[model samples]
Target chain A: MNEKIRHLREQMKRLNLEGMIVSNPISIRYLTNIQAEGTLLITRKENIFITYAMYMEDVNSTLTINDEVIVVDIKNISKDEFENFFLFCENVGFEEGYVTYAEYKKIYQRYKVNNLVETEGIVEKQRIIKDNIEIENIKKACEITDNCFSHLLTFIKKDMTEKQVANEIERYFKENEADGLAFETVVAFGENSSKPHWIPSDRKINSGEPILIDMGCKYNGYCSDMTRTIFLGCILEEYKPYYDAVLKNEILSLDQIKDGVVVKKATEIIDENLKRNNINLIHALGHGVGMEIHEAPIIHTNVESYFKENMVIAIEPAVYFPSNYGIRIEDTVVVTKNGCIPLTKSDKNYIVI
Target chain B: MNEKIRHLREQMKRLNLEGMIVSNPISIRYLTNIQAEGTLLITRKENIFITYAMYMEDVNSTLTINDEVIVVDIKNISKDEFENFFLFCENVGFEEGYVTYAEYKKIYQRYKVNNLVETEGIVEKQRIIKDNIEIENIKKACEITDNCFSHLLTFIKKDMTEKQVANEIERYFKENEADGLAFETVVAFGENSSKPHWIPSDRKINSGEPILIDMGCKYNGYCSDMTRTIFLGCILEEYKPYYDAVLKNEILSLDQIKDGVVVKKATEIIDENLKRNNINLIHALGHGVGMEIHEAPIIHTNVESYFKENMVIAIEPAVYFPSNYGIRIEDTVVVTKNGCIPLTKSDKNYIVI
Candidate 1:
């Protein structure tokens, strides 16, 4: 049996749960090496995997499972899959706020589940504290990202359309052996940069305006996220003040990041700096980065969570002047006991393109 | 003023729906120029959208919607965005099976939604029959796919990993200005071709095996789905019967297809021929191809629907022989009153790679 399955059993025991159902794909991947696409139900006595036709092959080919872990395909099974599941579990701890009425109806009609508690953060809380294997993969993903950036920079000159630059980045991503782009590559230029999460358009890059390139790459299944902002032509003296504030704030927030640091507190620091500059940082200060580009330990104003060792995150704070200009600097990092180490090796110097 | 939104409004009025909540992004995009990264609620009275930060900017910039279409930032709106959505909607006809319990709580709680109806084929029923603009883009996407195939064939001669071939297709997709590969380009050679959805492995291609290349391109937001199986070097004479049967079935099905033709009925003919060869088809006969590759009007056994006029679909019937080889011939076609018009003009011939 995998250690994760045993660890989860302990969690179930502590919560007074007879069983727990794991449906979220990421959580399933985390618990079992079963790359099989499906849900895994962990009971006090037995652990079961519900799958379609495809995931069966994946489990057989890749995963190492204990004999006790049962595998059932919904196709070959009866409607009793849900009924049988509930019958087995008495005091069940489910994912908090993750189930639907439709799902509830099927289960409710099937079994008399008395103890259904919403235990949302248990697995995610564990995930935020990464093992050594996760850190190595994430670091490798970052290295791939950096290499892609280095190759892409040589091609991103003045007058390149946002789409063209995006194309180049994607091209380099594959050539450099990335699984794929972690997310849609954002290559906003000039005034367009004002819109955070702007899709790469065909707008031409012009002198005197800043260009923002936010991109990431997926290595294996783990993802790396990075964003860099640079201005074209001469670096404007007036822009530097706002840019410096953003940079100093990003570095300062990252500096505060360490194991046991509260996420809300980190946001307060960024908020205080942004307040000093009379800017509203509408987004969260930072967010955990891992298999999914955005994951657990969301560092914001209200999240009741703290950082932990081996947890990777992207600390990005931006000052946007809507329809005018915007500046943001971001990096991938891991929380250490003392502080954090930058996973992204891309240079963050303010420069002219 | 877009026609799709107008059409949806008519649907809402007929359903006595005060409003319709669209959770599928592609469906939202089909109706409104606005693609919902999160969800879009459309009432007979008004339209609203809730999406993440990234796509909201793009849609807001491009779409011209009525003032009342409230676009909410889902990340900021609720405790958990998916659960929050259920809370936001009232008396809504959800895209029933599409939404999970994780997504229904908030809107479901907020609304007196006893009138919750399962909208079986709302967007898909509409999307199955595309308009002029959609057809033009799908045609263009197919052309791009065809050209990439022709170009790659000119250069590929052996001694390349499956990854390299996949990369080459991606490069050609970019070089010819495709949005991106519609899905990860599948390049399987020899025995790897046996698995229908084989992810490109690092294995080198060997001679004397049937090669399968299933690829597509997304031009604009519309996509093209296609699959082409080719024989490398010379093949045994016995294999020709299977190849002929596959091609004959595709041609016969294309001839028999017309508006109002039962989808599975089309597959029944192929299934009968497949039985003659003692082969069981693993997947559905075909699927409606549109903005999304696998849309609606699934052509398979137990499908209780029929193809309608203007409905575009990819009719692919494959025969899989484990550990040896397989043959699949696919093409995109438009359902019409008389019979069918083949949209993807790429001829499936015995290409000796």
Candidate 2:
């Protein structure tokens, strides 16, 4: 069996769960490496994947004998077979976070298990600390992202539309061996940058205005996220202090991220620094990045948790002035024993394009 | 109140629900035109949208006095306030398909309502029939998609990779005033086309091979989906029959799409025709396309439903030969009283580039 599945089984045993149904595609991929539309069943003695006929070939091609996964086509499976998969199991687990209420009812009727319990995010918690191969893929994705940012510095020009700039970044990532974008590229120019989750519009870049580009790409199923706020021609005098404070806080936050560091404490430090500058941290300080751009160990003042080594996360510090402009600097980094190693090595200093 | 919300309230009356929670963002956008992270509550006397502080500005800006949606910051609302949102209501409806089991529990505890009943997809079923504005947006999107296909014919070269072609299509849409892709462009070269949902890879195009491109784009929150399988140089003798049969069935299926036409009958006709050619239809014939690429009134043999007027749908007929190549032709159309009007008008005739 794969190391991930073995680890998952151990966790299942600890939870007293005799069987589990992993329906979230990301979790399925994490366990079996089968990127198909299917439901993964972890019974007492078997790891089975049920999919439609269309995906059977892809699932078969992705799995091997060592994976210990049996692929069954949904068209060929009978209701009795589904009910019998976990026949003698005492308790079955389901992803409460992903499974819809209606689906919960349907699964209850179909599986006919004694008790269907929430898995308590057992797979997701395990995913917080990525394996070695996961780190390598994320590192490669970050390298490509940095290169794309470099290309954008030269490609971006005054009067160019934000959508155009966003498109170019996507094209650059695709041409540079990226699987795809981790999320939609956010290219906010001038006053539009004030919104934390601004969608790229036809707003044109103007001289002496801030341009925030929050972008990421996927490489080998791992994700890399980075955001850089730059100036079109020259930085405005009033914006200089805000940019300096944001950069300072970003660095302070990254410096505090290490093994055994409290997630909330690190975020509090950044929040305090921002507060000193008369700015508030609007969103979470950052979030863990892996197969999904946003995952476990959310760096927020409300999350009571600790950072663990091998966990890759994005740390972003920002200052947003409503209807004016925003300055945010972010980087994807890997948590280390002492500190954290920044994977996205883009220049944070003020740059005039 | 907006027509969409008014229609929803009427449906709520029929379901014997006094209050409802609309958590799906797409449904919320359809009702209030607010494209932000929020939960919409349809109370007896008010339309309330509760969102986080970050989305307050965007949501407020998108909504107006006529939208009648009162935006509230989640931070300002207390637990008691949450419990009062659906107060004095005997039954409150929820989107069972969208809300997860955990969220269902959370809402149940928070709302403090007498009964939480499924809305039975009241909003989604209403969305099946596109309004005038929605149809206009879908038509515009389809126009751009057709133009994109035209551009690809001239731009695609012998050695261009599948990813390159997919990127170019995306760039074309972005440059031409698209809201972005409705879904990821599926570009399969030669043998890769056998898989219906093949992700574009590094596979390069070759002479005398099939190039299947299934692409779409969003315009004004509406979607357009189309697929075309073209020959790079020449259609092989064995593949011509499959292409011709798929094209014939695609047209036959589209011709049968009209107001009040039985959905299952339309799909059954296509299936029977494909069976005569010794080919099996592996997937649904098509799906309704509006705000989402795939929506209600799924064109399948199992669905006991009827096509309604102004319902936008995609009719796709395909033939796949595993380990070889596949041919599929699709188009988005609007069902009318007598027949259907094709939105995507890309030529189905075999083209050798």
Candidate 3:
């Protein structure tokens, strides 16, 4: 957290601003170890965590921070609070992209404030590269994730619904060793597999339909994301080609994920790979996988961001048939000088089991 | 949703509000069935939903609303757009609790508006009572939760870490027929259970210690919450008194949960019971549970809200021994005219498997 605070302070120096208003809860949590749904007002001079709820006890018990962290309660928020805080800054920078017009009024009118600038994505930009601890946690999370999936394969039967499979995965995560799931387990079977963000349903896994499972686990606050699609029964010889295409594309993207490469180029390779197989690829090529599943340096074949060394990202090569089925192969990876290391260790080969 | 809207309209009438501005995402989702992170401006003359993101597409796919849900892009928000929509509203009400000061400024300044009044708990009031469908979903969610816990009991072992057990419960929910767990799976072992909201850790379960597991499942869109603390090994005679105190408190609360009893009174009963036993309870008795794990009509001894029939509330009787050990038993229940229907069926038995 101290390191994060230092990073923000350096950002303030670069922007020639005295302070920044961090409203995004995720960013606040990452920076302060406080996970409450609240806003953070940070400046070069001081930092105040504001909340309407009484979080004092929670802060004292759970949130360990340096003396630099100050807790503030919203009680008739006075203009003096903003001015006193902002006086240290030449300009007040806000995460403008996340805040709304209504939010602006409360701060400006109530505080009689002025000189606010939009400085979005700076924290996220820094978050793209994982620290050693963060990477280790991610790896541990992935290890738990892989073990859970392996157990699921053994526990799963044909009679179970997609929801059941999802639940089993969740239970396995807890039983194996995971703080919790990084996100909602996506267990889509047959037609449901077509929806990229399909919520698990009660529909049972049938004999001939394709099943796609996208899941992640959080270990020590870091997260790992992985996705694998398989068929309940014997895979048709024709579908194997598409499966092979996705696997090859994922491996190809992993091989290409070295330092100093444009993110677009990697996505383009996967895109061309899918196109070669005449599959309609949907969604982005991949995304950064860390404390947050989808972070920065997005691999979309057109993003301006470039892959840098030590940046952990997911490479998901998918082919969707809206009314029929969808197949996606995703693996979390850390960008290296030469290539990348896959975080999740699931055998992506078309499993007959 | 119509009933909810009508209920809120009646609240508006009572509060002398002609319209309301709901910026809280949960409130908006509850009112319109539009699961979009945006604002919903409700007036007698006009209703509008505004957002900067392409939530319209998401809403269209996710929700089936009766009224014509308006879509407002952030780029097009002007004074005319804000004022014209609320032209007929003599007193426009706003969710002051949720609308941040900064957002308030952006709206007030951009719209050149000054007529909106702070409307407190208008939508929250309607969300208290459980409808038939909501109750139905809650029941299914609870059933799934119960089944998951039962499966968990079958596989209980001494050496498994808290993380692994937590993972198993989550997986069970997804596989059995659930959207996901309602909240983080709390699998606190032994002394770790001392923290009421303990994050699952990599601690091994030891014999003779209380294994406290608080977990829930989300089915459909509704949620179920339940908690059970059990002796992992042999029962300690010294701990039986503490265990019995918590158990008796829950049973008494359940017996008293009839139509028209003040919810706070029920909470006070437990507090008094614990006090009589020389125990100082630190947290609230329970809370209203539904679409959200914690909702309106909090079961806190200090609160003034009364219990009503058909309200789904969580009854949690917990005894926290700070820094040493703790035990809590919680179950989601629906208050009935005669008594209450227990939604969660996870056995809160004192004995271990």
Best by lDDT: 2
Per residue, candidate 2 scores C-alpha lDDT tens digits across A1-353 of 99999999999999999999999999999998898898999999999999988778779999978899999999888899989999999999999999999999999998999999999899999999998999999999999999999999999988899988987888788788898799988999989999888888888988999999999999989999999999988989999999999998888877888999888887888788899999888789999999999999899999888999999999999999888999999999999988889999999999999
Task: Show the lowest summed lDDT stretch of 10 residues, model 2 chain B.
Answer: B52-61
Q: What share of the true interface contacts does each candidate keep?
A: 0.30, 0.97, 0.13
- Rank ordering of all candidates by TM-score, starting from the highest: 2, 1, 3
**Residue-wise lDDT of candidate 3 within A1-353, one digit each (tens)?**
48888888798778877778888877787788787767788766677877754466676465565636777667745767656666645677777656655576566564443577777577887788778878898899988888877877777678788877876776677556676679988999888887888888778887877889999988877888999997876786767888888889889989987898887877787687789899767678888887787778778877866778889988888887776888888888889999998889999998755
TM-score (all chains, Cα) for each model: 0.89, 0.95, 0.75
- Using DockQ as the yardstick, the better of models 1 and 2 is 2
Query: Between 2 and 3, whose TM-score is larger?
Result: 2
Off by over 4 Å in 2: B237-241
List model 1 lDDT by residue over A1-353, tens digit each: 77777877787788778877776777877787666677777765678887887667667666664635777776886766566666756687667454554565555564456676667667876777777788888898899888877776676788889988897888788767688889998888878888778888879998887889888988867889998898777677878888889988888877888888887887787799889997799788878888789888788889867777788999989989888888888899999998889999898888775
Q: Write the per-residue lDDT of candidate 3 for residues B1-353, one digit (tens) a residue.
A: 46777778788888888877788877887777777677787767556777755456776666456555566776687667666766656787877667755566565665444476777667777888878988999999999888888887877798888877876786577657787779988989888888888888879988888888898988877889999988776877877888889888888888887788887777777789988987787777888888788888778877876788889989888888767788889899999887777888766667676
Off by over 4 Å in 3: A20-25, A32-119, A139-178, A201-211, A229-280, A305-307, A336-353, B13-25, B32-119, B139-179, B187-189, B200-213, B228-273, B329-331, B334-353
Q: What's the true lDDT of residue B333 in model 2? A: 96
Give Cα distance to truth, residue A28, candidate 1, Å. Answer: 1.1
User: lDDT rank, highest first?
Assistant: 2, 3, 1
